[model samples]
Each structure stands twice: as structure tokens, then as C-alpha cells.
Target: MSATRVLTLNVWGRGSAWRRRLPLIRDGLVRIAPDLVGLQEVWRKRSGCQAERIADGLGYHVTYGAASSRRGCATQGNALLTREPVARYDVLPLPVPDGVEPRSVLRAEVGATTVLVTHLTWEWEHASVRHQQVRFLADLTHLAERRGGRDVVLLADLNAAPDTDEIRWLTGRMADAWVSAGSGPGHTYTPANGFARKAREPARRIDFVLSAGPRAVHAELAFTTPVRARRRTAWPSDHFGVVCDLTSDPGAP
Candidate 1:
């Protein structure tokens, strides 16, 4: 089948930066014009909703699955955006220990693919929690395949490094876009944390695009978005965006 272009990003729905970064984020998406997007940390305040505004303005279809709302975003959660109309969608709440922020996965179907968007727990020290989450995801993916489904593509901010067990669990079941077709470190996180820009910490490629299916094969890492601003020196969010192109076997699932 023809290739599909997908983008995934964590929009950093917290703090005062949201207002400042909207323009840059909008422009970034417009430039990429991806066929589909799996966004984490999408916000919805009384003034406006991040996904709605972007979708309505750019003519992309959107579906949101909320997990919490400090909600700076009344419906703070994961969002799946597609240039084409979604044939179906599902939102599943993920398991998380009490006190940790709730997590959820937003799944959608467009054309011959099943796309899942999610944001997992962020504690680097809490590998156990991440592992449990990955197991659940693996099981869910298997269930879909058994039930007869198209290629499944998982896009998320996993918060786990490539070499980490949590990521290994996922990569073992699905192909990592970066590993299959990418160069450089593929770092996605960039936290300032009130420190000088470069002094805070180095970036990490916690974000990922993974796939598994009889037809899921030959993935090309299109590029990663910078999210930098023309008006402001700061980035749209603390995370970089990933874009990947995938060619599926037309005769297979």
C-alpha cells in the first residue's frame, strides 16, 4: 500500500508556556501537514481547546481521551488527529498506581491502519510501573491482531530510553522507527527546569513510533520537528516531534 506519514509529540500542556507556544505549534503542524498525528498532553481550557482549534482551523479530524484534568486542560489527555476521517476510535485507561498522574491510550482507525496514541508515566526511577504499562500495551496489541485488524502503529512519549527494559519490551514486539530508519541520538525531551537553556539537561528520545502486523514493514524516519519559534527563542514544548513514513503490504493485514 501507499506510505502513510505520522507525527507524534508531547505538547507540554502545563505552566504559562502554553499560551506563548500556540503559534509556533500551529505553524509547526501546518508545515509538516502529516496524514496523522498522535499528540500527548493536549490541553482544553475554558478559553479554547488545543486539539479543536488546531483541527478545526487546519481541517484535520480529532479525537481526545482524557485521563485527568488539573486539567489546566479540563480534558487533559491524549489526542489523535488525522487528515482523513476516522473510521472508528477507542480510548483505554491505563493502569497507574495511586498518586501518579492517570494515563490513557487513544486508539483510532484510518484507512488500513490502527493507530494508538499515549503518554506513559514520567518517573525515570519508576521502571516497574513503565514495564507493567508496556505489558498491557503488548497484550492489547496482540488481542487486536488476533481479532483480525490492520497494521497497528503505536505512537507515544514512553519516557524510557531505547536501552531500558521498558522500551526493550515494546521493541521486542514491535519495530522501532528510529532504530529501523533514523540517524543521530533521536532525543525528544528538552527540559529547562528554570536553569539556563543548555545547563538544565541533555535531550532524550523518549518519544517513539512503533509498529507490528503482517503488513507492517519498511519504515522510514521522515524527520523530527524542532518546535522553535520566530517570535520567541523558546521552543513550542519541551519535547521534539517525530515523523515517520511506513509502507505496508497491500495483500496482508
Candidate 2:
């Protein structure tokens, strides 16, 4: 089986200097050149989707799934980018409780593998809601495994800390790339980020790359550099990205 390099990140939608950040995002992605990329908070307009804009001239097959809509634009959601051709694509809408934003998972079939991308509810008080969403994702993964018998890579900006019940529940079932291979705290959401500081969230590793059938070999944070432009400094997004290398797990079920 072929090895896969996976990257997962939350693009922060169109918030806070997105126009300036988009160029840096494109450049950073070009350098990393991941085999598969899962993006959350991607914005789409009448003109085109953010996935298409990033995939432009990059040779990646793009699939986007809308989770919510903005007033002036069409929608915003999760997206999957595969370097190879995708055999199939599907979108699964997730549960949306009262006062919570919509969310969905983007699924792509590449060769013999299945990749699922999603973003869960963000508020710290929304743990219960995230729990439900995690259950849904777990079911989806199991169903896909039964249907395809293919390797599965689940990527997301889950918005929960590592020690949180939702995260613990998930890592117990699947291999968390960062836990297995990353050094240091592996905090993706840091107060050091100019864009993230406004959110008042403490430094935490809420984003994840998980695999059921692939062995995580190495993992690191990406797009951590802050770029100064037009008298302002910003990282590619409010959250850093997780990049991981995965090899097929021969004994995986």
C-alpha cells in the first residue's frame, strides 16, 4: 500500500485579514505538498470555493461540503483535497443543536483509501454537542470500513482539548497522529497568533489527524510562521495546521 502524507487545518473562514492570509496559505501549502489535505471553515461564494482557489495550479482534486451560509456569500464548510484522482465523493451533514452552527463531513475515495474531513462545534460549553457529533463520525467511519474495506483517515478541527472527554473517546478508538508522533505540546490554537488572540482561547491542540487503518509515523505543526503585511501581523489562519505521515497498518481491521 502506498504511504500518505495528510494535512488538516482550520482556515478561519473569511475572518480577519483573509485577503492577506490567502497568499501565505497558498505558498505554505505549495511547500508542504501533502498527498491529502482536509480544510475546515472554507468559504464559498458565487464566484468559486476556497478549495478551488487553493487547488488552482496545484493539481489536486477538490471536494467541498457546505455546512453553513453567509449573508453575502453562498456557504462555508469543510473541504478535501487529494493529489490523486478521487473515485467517489460524498457529504454527510452533522447534527445541529439549537444556537449552534451547522456542520458536515466531506468524504473522498482515493484509490483504495477513504478520507473523511469535518469540523465540530467550537464553544467550550458545547461539549455535549461535540459528543454527539463524534458519535456520528464514529458511526460513519465504521460504516465506511464495512462498505469499502479500505484504509480510513479522519481529519478535523475538532475544537476540543486533548484531555477532553470527546477527544479521549475518539483517540481511544482511532490512532491520533499527534499523540503517536508529535513532539512538545502540539498546540494548534495558540494565543500567540494575532488572529486567534481575539478569540480569547488558550493554547490548545484542538485539531487532529486520526487513522483507523494507517500507522502514524511522524507528525508536526505547519503554517506556524507569522507574516507581516500592511502594518499587521498574522499567521496563515487562527489555528496552526497538523501535518502527518502515515503508512499502511498491515494488521489493522
Candidate 3:
């Protein structure tokens, strides 16, 4: 096993000014130069798509899982952009609640590491759904290991706080990349007006890059800077992005 750098973020989708922030997203990702990146809320249109656009700019391999298709001409989903070509991979539709937007996971291998990219149910109303999704994610990671891969990572936007059952369950099973190699609370989600909302709720860290291997994954706490757009009218996304560097343990199976 060697070294790997992974990043994950919710790209804010096309629901808003996706076009305006596209350059910021591309520049931010290119600046980090991660080996692989996982993005939630990526969109696809007839002419092109977000992942493909960024992949083209950064020269990274692109893989996506469309959760739904609109009128047969448009699509929206999660995506994986890797510096190395992804040869083996699959898109899995995750188990969802009775009536909610369908979700999915993209599993791919870049070189020797298996990366699982996904976005879970959002909002308090879907907490139980998130719980189920977390358990399923745990099962999926283990499944990847059983399939002959040693280094496995989960990049996602879970929409849950750190102490909640969902986060506890996930960090309990997989190593939270930030725990070993991050500074501060690493808050990825914040209220629209953080100062005004603190009385009700503080910021939360929901986005993550969790990794598990038969052996240790050395992560340097050098810097996991959150990329924030400086523009007033538009920002990179509603949530912040995390950038971290990880090296696979030599003894990894």
C-alpha cells in the first residue's frame, strides 16, 4: 500500500446558482490535487455534467450514480473524481424510506484503495432513514473488504451531528479521518446565520472522509482546510469542503 489523498463535499447541486459556483468548485478541487474526490448532489444534463466538467478541468477519472432521471433527458446524482483511472466499480441504489428521494453509493477502486462515495438522507424528519443508511454503509465497507480490497474509505454527506447515533455508529466502525488528522471541530455545516442561530443550535460536522484498512492508514494533520468561496453573491456550496492526505499502512492486507 502507498499514499492516497481523498476529499468529499456536497457540490450544492443545480438547485441554485450552480453555474456561477462551478469555477470555484473546480479551482478549489484542483488546488488540493487529491488522488480522489467524492461529491454529493452532482447534476447531469443532456449536453454535459458537473463531474465531467470538473474531471475535464482536473484530469481525473469520473464515475457517477444517478438517483433519478427527469423526463429522460436530465439526471442528478453522486459522483467520484479520481486522478487515476477507475477500472472496477459499481453504482448501488441505497435502501430508502417509503416516500423520499432515492439515494445511492458509488464504489470504485483507484489503484489499491477502495473508495465508497455517497450522500445520506437530509433533514431531521429523515433521521431514522440516516440511521438505516449508516448501518448499510457499515455493511457495504465490510463487503468491500471481503471482496479482496484492503484499504477502504467512505466519503459522504451524512447530515448528522457528531454525537448522534448515526455518527457514533459510523465512527465506531470506521476511523473518522479528522479525528487523527484534523484540527478544530471540523464543522462542515453551519446555520445560515451562525451567530443568530447559536442559541438554538451550534454548527455541526456532517461531511466526512472515513477510512478503514486491515492495517493503519497514516493521515497527516498538516492541513484539512475548508475551501470557502470569497464571492458575495455565490459561494462554493452551502456546506464547506474538506481536504486531507492519507497514506496506506505498509502492512495493510
Considering every candidate listed, which one attains the maximal TM-score? 2
Candidate 3 lDDT for residue 89: 88
Candidate 3 Cα misplacement greater than 4 A, ranges = 192-202, 214-231, 250-253
Cα lDDT listed for each candidate: 0.76, 0.88, 0.76
Model 3 C-alpha lDDT per residue in residues 189-246, reported as the tens digit of each score: 7654222134365578888888887222433321223334544455567677776667
Per-residue lDDT tens digits of candidate 2, residues 216-242? 888999999998877888789999999
Worst 10 residues of 2 by lDDT: 244-253
Report, for all candidates in order, the number of backbone clashes.
1, 0, 0
Q: State model 2's lDDT.
A: 0.88
Candidate 2, number of clashes? 0
Task: Please report the TM-score between candidate 1 and the true structure.
Answer: 0.86
RMSD (CA, Å), each prediction: 3.5, 2.2, 3.9
For model 1, which pairs clash? 188-204
**Per-prediction TM-score to the true structure, in the order listed:** 0.86, 0.95, 0.86
Candidate number with the higher lDDT (1 or 2): 2
Writing each residue's lDDT as its tens digit, candidate 1 over 49-87 gives: 788765678878888888677825377888888888999
